[model samples]
Target: MIISSPAKQLNSKLSSQEQEARQNGYLFAQLVRLYHTFDGRPGNEYSKLQDAIACVLDKIDQNDHPYAYTNKLVMFIEARHALRGLYLSPDQNKLLIDLRENTKRTNLNYVYLSAIDATSQFK
Candidate 1:
């Protein structure tokens, strides 16, 4: 889905930190959209799920633009917390827990993969 022009303009004017916030907001919006589409599915929808998640992470990695960094961190933290509360298999839950723990030490690439895995399992 296309991000709104006004939002894009606003995002373009943010600081690096602020840019992260805008990216998180955009990512959260996309996840909500995905949830609506895959809310009651059975088994895993790996391909589309990964694509949706990658889109968000790609935006995050493309942090050359201005952003709301604090806001993005807040949103990402909140989203991750909420996601942790959803029903998941033990392995999926473990993956999320690992991702959360590792995020403190490593870059966020694995977080994207964990998101895809968790959403595929639970959503």
Candidate 2:
């Protein structure tokens, strides 16, 4: 009996879409970390709740759906805000926006799987 490798390997080089999807996954992991940090720290609970709500509304207003390409940068900014109480500088914001714009549509399933895989690695 001979062992043969399949044409499509899990460790194969990622396509551009897969790479972007993986980055988004990593960004999401960072956001979760920020949220946990913010939650655990001693602070004004009311203010934290307010800021969390505001962040959700801001994402909705900006049409940043979780599966959409725009969500990556929105979550990035929002996570930093949650962690540091500050937004990205204008240049940084513009750079994220440009990157988001350049990413084409990706398979939602692939994105979800990639995000899950990326986040799982953190633990």
Candidate 3:
């Protein structure tokens, strides 16, 4: 038996979207690492992480690329979900919730699924 690959046009589109999607994935991974490193503790590190996330969001907001906007919104949602698992204070939780809501209000699409799951579905 033989299986055919996706069409060239589909591959091209997926490749372009994948570039931004991968960046979003990386940001979420970084947030997860930070959450692990500072679980249940409020300190400079936590503040720094929050600042970094804000900076990323600001950069995304300034970006005119549609893919960048979608990627950034997805990253924000993923990061917020990852942060929720960590033992964060009420204030921290509120911050994440606010971030999620703000990102949701953006024009970008925020469809999210595990990378592996998405890839498998495509296959």
Candidate 4:
């Protein structure tokens, strides 16, 4: 005999919409951890945030969520500027529009889950 739990059934039916519903907060937290990792290590924290964004840009398609993703990125850039209060350009909004769109990101949920697991180790 075999029985599946409701949660199991729900997990099996998750589509891109479900994935889109869940934003990448774990990844964002990991990035923030990395950004603040060098508080006294003598390097530019802003550059570290740029590197984090670069890593994300390498993995994510621009069409992942367009306006939503761009807004999130803008927030990241804003967070990085909190200390300096610097007025600067994110330079990622236009690229988010221009980058080629993918019809599907088959592994986005898996990626997010992995991020959650990876970041959990920090606790």
Name the regions of candidate 3 deviating beyond 4 angstroms. 1-84, 107-123
TM-score of each: 0.28, 0.31, 0.31, 0.31
Model 4 alpha-carbon drift over 4 Å, by segment: 1-43, 61-68, 87-123
Across residues 1-76, which tens digit of lDDT does each residue of candidate 4 receive? 8899998888877865566544444334443443444345444655555564555543434334333333344445
RMSD of each: 14.3, 12.0, 13.3, 12.5
lDDT of 2: 0.43
The backbone clash count of each candidate, in order, is 10, 0, 0, 0
Error of 3 at 53 (Å): 0.9
Q: Which one wins on lDDT?
A: 3
Backbone steric clashes in candidate 2, count: 0
Candidate with more favorable, higher lDDT: 1 or 4: 1
Q: Which TM-score value belongs to model 2?
A: 0.31
lDDT tens string, model 2, 1-123? 965456445445446548756655554544444344344445565244335434533443444543342344344444555665654455545544544454335333332323321222111
Candidate 3 C-alpha lDDT tens digits along 1-123: 866567877888899878866655544544344445445556554544455445444444454433334345335534544754434556545545544553454544333324421211111
Candidates sorted by lDDT, best first: 3, 2, 1, 4
Q: After superposition, how far is residue 105 of candidate 1 from its true place, in Å?
A: 17
With a 3 Å backbone cut-off (N, CA, C), the pairs that clash in candidate 2 are none
The sequence of per-residue lDDT tens digits that candidate 1 reaches over residues 32-75 is 44334435545444344444444445444555221232223323
